[model samples]
Target: MFSRFVAWAKRNLPTRESMEANRWLRPVAHRVLEPSLWRFTRRSVPRGVALGMVTGILCPVAQVPLSAIFALPVRANIPVAALTTFITNPFTTPPLWVAAYWIGSRILHFGEGMGVEADAARGWMEWLFSEAGPSLVVGLTLITLVFAVVGYGASALGWRWWIVRKWRARAEARAA
Candidate 1:
């Protein structure tokens, strides 16, 4: 199942050549097409995962391009970074934001005066202008940082484990 999904992604996702030809990226096509950034090394893959998580969680718009650009500086795997941005799509965003708000409320001790329910009753503009605004911003920032750190650590550990497993499997096959 995972192999099929990977194959599908490879076939459907834009290629390096296609990206190079992109009108918007034409100015920096040379840098964007650098070979090192596209390689799937252990270091690059983990960096890409972290970068993707940060960009994906922090912003709802242009995450793929954002990750791709950031990946260049970090020498992260471009495709991995780009694909990871799907962590926050239309279907998952609402719930994620709600969770962020909940977390923010807890951390910031919101609703002490009139209560959270009363705050929710206010108009959208008023709510946004109130404590909810700072809470949401702080929550999103904290969530983004946490996700990036966790993503990086998990990917690094998973990559190391995969390599070790492959080595062991190869040794067993040779012995057989």
Candidate 2:
């Protein structure tokens, strides 16, 4: 199942072909698309997911570019890293921010008034800047870190489980 999903994802996702067309990157296109970097191997994909999650939350606006920056150095699956950033898109951001604020308030013990008051008197930006800013930053940072670690671990475990399942199936076939 995991193999199929990875295979499907690879097919659907864009390759470095478009990026390779860039004059600057064209010079290093081959290095950029090194097979190991794109392959759905246990190591590459997990690290790619971790890289993606970290960038997705931390650099919401430039998540893909940030993921690529990390992916190139580590040779993780570039497309997966880029794709995973979608986890924090427009619909999700508000809830995520809210959760982060709540978590930050608990962990850091920011006083009772973390809530945005019914301030028709002040704008949302003013509210965010004055009340929510620091806690949001700390909370988002912590959430991003936790997600990165968890994503990496889940991928690694999935890979192991897939390998074990394949081995069992092969052994059964041999016995038959």
lDDT of 1 by residue, 2-91 (tens): 999899998987789899788998899899998888888999999999999988989679999889989888899999998999999889
Q: At residue 121, what lDDT does model 1 achieve?
A: 82
Badly placed stretches (over 4 Å) of model 2 are 1-12, 113-127
Highest TM-score: which candidate?
Answer: 1
Q: What is the lDDT of candidate 2?
A: 0.83
Q: Per-prediction TM-score, please?
A: 0.90, 0.81
Q: Tell me the tens digit of each residue's lDDT in model 2 across 2-77.
A: 9997898778766767676778777777777677887888889898999899889888687887788789888788
Show the lowest summed lDDT stretch of 10 residues, model 2: 111-120
The number of clashing residue pairs in model 2 is 0
Worst 10 contiguous positions by lDDT, candidate 1: 111-120
Pairs that collide, model 1: none
lDDT of each: 0.89, 0.83
